[model samples]
Target: MTVTETTTAPAKIWDKAGGWQGVGTAVGILALTRVGQLLMIWWLGGATSEPRSVWDRLLVWDAGWFLRVAMDGYPHGYTYENGVLQGNELAFFPVYPMLIRFAAAIGFTPSTAAVLISWIASIGAAVALHLLGTSLYSKRAGWALVAICCSAPASVVLSMAYSESIFLALVAGMFVAAHRRAWWAAGLLGLLTALSRPTGAAAALGLGVAALIAVREIWKSENRIAWQPITAAAAALAGVPLYIGWVAWRVGDLDAWFKIQTAGWGTTFDYGSSTIKFLNTTLRTGDGWVSISIALMLLVALAAAGVALTQKPWLPLAVYGVVAMILVYGQAGFYHSKPRLLLPVLLTLLPAVVAASKARPRVAILSIVAWAAFGLWYGAYLVTVWPYTL
Candidate 1:
């Protein structure tokens, strides 16, 4: 019996080391969680007489902008209709639209392509997140991280026509590459990520930090430094500026990107004053459960940051998460969407998972399940109740 147990333990270790077992489990969890989201949405819609088709439901708000961009390229200049300045496709990033266009070229409608791309990218994001979590800790932590990510309150965006999944997949891939010291892969992934979303620049920052770490290690050893690190660092730092510069050139203003975001969509960076005002107004008005939910989300983000500081597991991840939160919450616009914005900064969940793991086994399972249940409920609320610009 002892010999049989010893052999089985080695087999289990080998299975984990092989990588497929953990990834398969993570993907299964992701798929099942998504099904739960679908069922909840369907049931709620039926009960409330909302009766929205799945495609129609997914293509709301920003999804329309992406579809417009894919079907019709950016306008030449500021588009005004009947003396009112209308938001143009230029405000949206190019990578997602390009993907939509490619799918359209192959005979898929823009809307179908958008949903398809988002779902595929979501799966990729989950798998990549799993890989990154495993690389950072153990396979168990990897699975736990996936649970947090897939069930996030705003993770419904992952199944929509938004760039979140694309950006997340690339971000996770960049970090995984950085961890493996594959500088070229990290650099290229970071470049693509920068094209996907403005926050992609935060991922680049993380990559640059990783490169700096590699440099220090090289310095510690009396060995020759590799060109990979330098190239990766340069690429990571340059990708965002290059995209912003292109946008500026197109609009014929050096600060056109910021101008478009501000003038077109009312999104501007006011150094947190707007956020403060928003919180004050929400509190004063007593917006009920939604306000409480948003406040709780803010607390979760802060707690994650605090836990990361205490654990100090990975500096790049810590920096990436901190910067992402700053960008999400410190910005002036779309206060209601702040929780959604913070969804991609997935490292925030690591501390919670770590804490859970240290607890008694049944307690840990119950707590994690409760967290996931709350996430699912909150996500359902975002989709059904009090519509915000998610």
Candidate 2:
């Protein structure tokens, strides 16, 4: 079906889900997943030799970078450690830290504000995911999307001081807005999504595709252009370059942001050479279970994404998924972070969610529970026991 036609029955589908009641149920499922993951973190944290509170564990790795940006602001130029230039807070996006600062100004500590904002955004993400699913398919698909996404292996980031929650919320909301032809909302949300992370560029590209489709339909029907979609597309397409340009102007270097990312996190886009090498080595002789598991997850995700495409999802969604996967797979970075980076790529989860939505209630529930059991525990283990960054 065309994008416009697919969204025509949203009101009927929303009523079928009981409207707000269905939304509440999705949020409730998200809450349950959060509780389960937190409990796992608490248990795992206590058993570690260097036991720390669950709160502290949630604030590790990138959380510290975000908090630093919130509290101190980005550095003016390159940061150095022992005369070696390093990645600075400039590599991190500003929206999440800006929100953290805003929340902190109202009376909470930075860490508390960071986690609180993340939790709130995660709820928003769940709501948006439900609406997107319900609009495109059915209420069952909506709930299934929420349950699967919330219980994904790296979904623990949803509750932590990470920007993924806010990014997910904005991206999903933007998709819903675009699907509904709410160009104003889509443009604004698209802008925010772009400001959230580098991956936002992929989302903006997807939005651009949606806008193009709208424009073509308008031309075919009335021999006229749709200015709203065109304007929204322009706004979204501007987001990434705007931020990068600002960084360049501020730092007096054209590629300052890219430099910072490469220096700090080894995040250069190497066209998948690094990833292929890692997979080859890991499959051949990797010793660590974690490394091996991560390699396998990457393969499984690629397969799942392929399966999703065969199902012929919405055009914008499929575009976003393809580009996002390219960015994740083509990058030369932490091998273990691929799954976390893939969390907001809704396409990868479509197969399982659709299957669950079609199954009997008892069967679906048991299947999701089994998936969540390992997913929740695996995320908890990474944060509590793994020594490296997620």
TM-scores for every predicted model:
0.91, 0.96
Q: Give the 10-residue window scoring lowest on summed lDDT in candidate 1.
A: 1-10
Worst ten in a row by lDDT for model 2 = 6-15
Q: Model 1, range 1-390, lDDT digits (tens) per residue?
A: 110111101122123452446888888878977787777666665655566765677888899899888988886666677987666778787889999999999999889999999999988888887777777776667777788788888888887788988998999888877776777788888888888888888888888888787776766664666567678878877877887788778878787777778766677877778777777777678777787678667876888778777887688877888888788777877766888888888767878767654567687767767776877767766777656677
Q: How close is candidate 1 to the true structure, as a TM-score?
A: 0.91
lDDT of 2 by residue, 301-374 (tens): 99999999998889999999999999999999999888999999999999998899889999999999999999
Q: Model 1 clash tally?
A: 0
Candidate 2 structure lDDT: 0.90
